[model samples]
Target: MPATRTLATREAADLIELTRSLAVNELSPKAAEAEADETFPREVFRMLGRAGLLGLPYPEEYGGGGQPYEVYLQVLEEVAAVWSSVAVGISVHALSCFGLAAYGTAEQKEKWLPGMLGGELLGAYCLSEPHAGSDPAAMRTRAVRDGDHYVLNGAKAWTTHGGYADFYTVMARTSDDRSHGISCFLVQADTPGLAADPPERKMGLTGSATATMHLDDVRVPVGHRLGEEGQGLRVALAGLDSGRLGIAAVATGLAQGAFDLALRYAQEREAFGKPIIEHQGLAFVLADMGAAIESARATTLSAARLKDQGLPFTREASIAKLVATDNAMRVTTDAVQVLGGYGYTRDFPVERYMREAKVMQIFEGTNQIQRMVISRALSRPAKGTITVLSEN
Candidate 1:
């Protein structure tokens, strides 16, 4: 079933329709094969880029679609419904651009934003290290200043699009001050000494590659530095505020997809001389799933609206991430139950959906981390307080 969204503009509605069409025609048909083959759908991304779907939340001057975050997130949701790996790739690409788009100077934006947002160049974010997944301040990666460049040495773990990305937005320590010592850099993939480890074999989203990126004295020009030195942590956190919302939107979409599948299965599969949907117990489960999906979607969109309004939405974003992902985990699991034995096998997509939903709780800051963020925010006086929780 298509989501009945109350969009703010006609253009937004049209965009969603276009995204649905694209997902149906381009993403859905190939999703299973790509995942089965563990193939990264690079051409699909390029196709989305050509269709102006890659840079929806960025400014138009830099070859972006210039759509608001609300519209962009909905497009992401629509895409996620059909192909989660592609949706995750789009979200990560947006995150990779966040530091540069939000903090880069005019010259930096003019020089790099065009290609980066143009969809011709894919990007990866490098912040999480083997030991520093949640505590970014504890990261050991270092970027020492040279005459005209910075020599970076450290490994970033769990990098999406790791081996295939055209550029990387990296956060590395530039000084001894844990919180204030980090700096952000835009590093080209072909830079000497930079390499990607073999992709991790994952239980789900196999079509999207995940690998550790090794930066062994990789030299990046000073001009590629984003924002001021010692301000990388701030830039990274700012990006994550938006990234959490992206994940929230994706989670809601995943739940919605699961709910739709379960509802359809219940309606068509007869049991006890009637459709299972007519059974009171199964009917109640479907009702709960529908309510959960609606609630998750509402929470996610509310956060996006707060962000679009330029309000302090860190707490709301965390809540959205926590609620939406947890709901997805539950909803997808129940969707498999709705399908009975078929859901457990690869013959149906619900099994894949269930597997894909698991990681949503783990990434973009774990659900526990989200709770910590919410708790910290609640502890503070409510006078425009924004909790600064570190996320990778």
Candidate 2:
């Protein structure tokens, strides 16, 4: 089933069609094999870059597509529907660019933004450490300044596109102040003493490389630092709100893909004289899956709109991440059940979808952590002025 989207302009509609075509012709055919072999599809990314899909949300002046977040996310969703690893890779690449684009000096933007945004160079965000997965304030990575360079030492864990990326946006402690000590840097992948450990063996999305980055007295030029000396955590957190939205869109697409597979199976597979889809019990299950996918898509797009409008959407982004990922988990699992014994094997893609969906809830902030963020936002006092009513 094709997703019915309400696009805003003719350009947006055309972009979607172009994305769908690429997804169908290029990504879908290679996804299963690349994933099964645990091979990274670097060429696909290069192709996407050449086609201008890699920089959809960045400014055109810097060689980006200049589309709004809403449109970029929809394109991401289309890609995810065909190949999730590529969609996630694109998101991480965008997250890696966020600090420099949003906080770096004009000189830095002029120097590096074009290549990074143009997709000529893939990027990775290095924020999570083994001990600081949820609490970035506790990260132990240190970067001590010495004249013209900063000597960095520590490890970053669970970095997507880790070994394959051309550049890294790294965060490290620069002082003793828990919140204010951290600093961000745009480090080249080939910097001395900076090495990536072998990629992790995973449950799914094996096509997307995840590895630990080790920085052992790695010297980064002071000119590569992003933002102020102590603003790393702020920059990381700001990028995450947008990153969460990207994950939400990918999760929604995963759900949609699984639902489409299950629906088709229900229409063809029969336990009795009629198709299983005609049976009330199985029909209702399909209905619920459809509803969940639609709800997740709506929530994801609504959050994107809030972000595009320059509103405070941190709370909404968390909500969308939580809802969409949880929905994906449920939908993908039920898709397997709908396929019966066939779903448990590799013959169909639903099984792979199920495995891939499991991680969406855990990354970009776990669903549990998302709840904490939402509750904290709700507990805070409103920021804007309040209006008082007079007696009528």
- Candidate 2 per-residue lDDT, tens place, 76-180, comes to 889998899999999999999999999999999999999998867999999999999999999999999999999999999999999899999999999999989
Best by lDDT: 2
TM-score of each: 0.97, 0.97
The lDDT of model 2 is 0.94
Model 1: worst 10 consecutive residues (lDDT sum): 383-392
For candidate 2, the per-residue lDDT at 33 reads 97
Task: Write out the backbone clash pairs for model 2.
Answer: none
What Cα-based lDDT does every candidate model obtain? 0.92, 0.94
What C-alpha RMSD separates each model from the true structure?
4.1, 3.3
Report how far off residue 46 is in candidate 2 (Å). 0.5
Off by over 4 Å in 1: 383-392
